[model samples]
Target chain A: MYCRQPLRTIETIDDLHYNLQLAVELEFSTLPTYLQALYSIKEGSNTIAYSVIRSVIMEEMFHLTNAANVLIATGGSPALNSPEFIPIYPTFLPDNEKWFEARLLKLSPQALMLFLAIEMPGDLVPISMITIGKFYENIEKGLKYLDEKMGADLFPCGTLDKQIEHKYYYGGGGIINKVTNLDSALFALNAIIAQGEGAPNKHWDPDKSFPLEDTTGIESGDHQLFMQPRELSHFYRFNELKKGRRYVLGDSHNSGPTGPEININYDDVYNLKPDPQSGDYIHYPELEEMNFNVNVIFSRLLDQLHLAFNGQPKTLETAVCTMFSLKEVIQILMRNPIPDNELGEYAAPTWEYLSPEERTLSSIR
Target chain B: MYRLDDFYDLSATLTDYPVTRLIGTGVGNEYNQTLSQWVRQDVLDELYHCFSQLERNNDGQVCPQALRHQLLSNEKYGPIARNIIKMWYLSIWYKMTDNWSMTYGIPAYSSPVIGVESPTPEDYIISNNAYIQGLVWPLMGSHPMGAKQPGYGTWSDAPLNSIASIHLQ
Candidate 1:
């Protein structure tokens, strides 16, 4: 649904709670897709990818906790375990069809594109487009509508208030009616994005295209194997084994999967090594897209963990260590496409194993 | 000029004292005399000069709008001005608390920002003028106060009362 008002202008604790709720919802929405992607990976070979996905999913739980704490600290009740909490993917939004799409479990270039589109909607445009891109807009509308119906402000408590008491009934503290404004809205969005993706383009600044060829290990001609403009370099690449296409040394012409030009030699990449037992190479329809999704989810989780500990030094150090361990696990996964039956080795460190010092100050709680 | 050590010592003393007792003693009588010396007229004058520049109108009271506007107006002085405004407000509250203690034999407790309609001993025990000031202190430049205004007022009144009530009590 399109928001009747802008979200960036939010000024109260209620607004913060609402926005946090939206964030939690979005993270939850991504869960099923990620889990489905994890399941789609080859049974044994996807161990590391599976671990990465699982760890991120678990950390998202921590994010929800932090959001809840902030909400409570501001005298708002955190709505968890609610019927509306679990999102039905590809659900139609009020804005437009392109804005919402059917959830697809299969991994492919199209799937990855869909995932990216969902994860990062287009700029917050006043004039709604076919895609009706901004997710925050929907939240803004929902909050405003609720406020009008209730006839009370949310987060009436000001910043100077000493203690935001948790009230059992709804009327104690005021509700926040407005969402943050576009600039501030973008700042919060970008803060999360930058922590995951690199920094976003600044105002009036020319987009500095980082050619796909510059990515570590991957060559330019290899770019043609996937899709191109190859100029959109900030996104994750899902280069998988394709049977027919020749691995080019330094070409950068491919654009996207469904576009007029398709450069991937699916047969060549996948068929190179066939399984002796099955007399076929291990292949899945959209392995590249799946790989990309896994990578993006893992990277984003690491970023989120980093953000959780942003200001608190002790927590930051612990988070960094955890992140380092996660990175190590990812590296192992990258090297070994599939591991032996065991999965625990590749998984993130369990809470039990965390040092006492680390455990005491964890922001995860 | 007030030395950092003196400031730290005053802070330490304030930190240890009971919140209610501190409020009643007023600014001068409660804390160590050594620390109080630095906070006297000289410091107040310097603070007043800073406050005058920050106050948007000639009004003596520093309203949220005025504080927000002044601190956010310029790049060079914004952060420092904001911090000083916070510190000044806190210092006044602290002094008032001591005054309350001296004027009234009973401790004048600070009120809780939310839920409480009147002052209570719990409020006095828990409140810290400087710490609360540090929490709401604004950052540099003309950023919108946005959602912070209401909370600021609610919390600001607690200290304001702890200071002002001393005379009446």
Candidate 2:
């Protein structure tokens, strides 16, 4: 199918590597936007709303690691520090249609709707092989093609030692798989696809709901019936929040959430600046300090991830702690309101980490 | 059907605040079941028999003065009644043994460590749900951290009416 579509001419292993870097950047970009929106919700209200968004954000982190692991497995350096790699928001998701703009948003009806679209399973907007699902499908094909031609020397440029093992991640959705071979790589790719966008490899009917795992705790006596219903997909989970309810037993593909009403207090949310940039905080010294601390923690998180992928599993503890500590810093930023802003917005983390050179330059300035 | 309420009145002689108020915290059903389990069936039967033995006044109207005197002042039933109230308030089950003078007993009641103040508990460990549902939350005017979260900005406002009112709204 990828050969049938007009692709970006993947003639060599380097081309595959380039696309993997693009995948990494795409996965890395969503984390900031999701976290900013999650932190905007008031401390106690919207318990279900908080859990649903958090579940997605953790999976996005998992997806980032998966993409990097695949690149390392294929003997390619996973470049995370490139300047252009940090996405400019209101931009399209990696290979999404040009019309769908992914922006930093508060936890509003609008934000929930956008989350639904961003994670909408299946090729909702299929434009030649550009859907994220299709892009990964093409990567799977590229892996097979390289292996067939080069045999034992397919991934000669990279080493297995660079792969981030499953032990680094602390409790989330799927396991962090090492993609050393085609089967393992395909498993990792399928998790990214089915867990976010539905799988294309399974020969299930296109019109029918995608075959996902049944994570919904539905009570059932019939073993076959219980086994059949897939867990509500990520798209469906956000949709449940949008509908202001939960999915209960017997709710199916055609059915909506029939569970008890979830009381959501939207009026009490923090007013965060939409698509906030690192450049925007320069004028306010306090806000600038907040942004700096956020960046420092994030940089340390990346450094920890780098070390964990390189071989040391013990550093993952620091990575987990840094991930949680980022939330505390972002929470503080949420409390400090931005001045002279008519829109009634507050400070938020910009998700931009400065390198040592950039940090020295800022200090000098 | 023999309702547990027939055998014991948590509201009548136990809690100062209405027992129903604690029930409104949303952990009521499980809390009640756990408390019932903690107070064994034989103890409840003894409580029912003791309450029945309390003599009514000559006018056939039960005197509140006499009822308190009959229940709390008795030798055998006094501590058991007190422990029931403590179990509801603190969610900790005190052992029902009358052998406070005994030097030692079962392994469950094994001696405390050198620095520790008390011996190990023989009463079953209370469920975490019961601990969260303990009468203390209403006294503090807050729910447990992870369970039954009161809505956003609720802290700034007065506590829920459920804390004060006896009747279910």
| Candidate number achieving the greatest lDDT relative to the actual structure | 2
lDDT by residue (tens digit), candidate 1, A244-305: 12223243323222212224322221111110111111242122222333334344444443
What digit string (tens of lDDT, one per residue) describes model 2 on residues A1-365?
A: 01122346565888888777777877777777778788888766677788777877777777788888888887776665434556667777765445477888888888888887777655555444355666777787887888787776765545666677775654346777777677787778767776576445546444454343433532221222113354445676787788877666655445667676776788868878888887777887767766777777777677776676555545666667567557756776776667688888877777765676655436523
Worst 10 residues of 2 chain A by lDDT: A217-226
Interface RMSD of each: 26.1, 16.7
The parts of candidate 2 lying over 4 Å away from their true place are: A1-9, A127-129, A155-158, A199-230, A249-254, A310-314, A360-365, B1-169
Tens digits of per-residue lDDT for model 1 on B1-169? Answer: 3343333223322233222222211222212332233234354344345545644345544444755554346343343333333342333222233332233212234223456563432212112322322222221211123421322223322232234323543
Worst 10 residues of 1 chain B by lDDT: B135-144
Instruction: Evaluate every candidate with DockQ and list the scores.
Output: 0.01, 0.01
Q: Model 1 misses residue B168 by how many Å?
A: 81
TM-score of 2: 0.61
List pairs with backbone clashes in candidate 2. Answer: A75-A158, A213-A231, A214-A231
Which ten residues in a row are the worst by lDDT in model 1 chain A?
Answer: A270-279
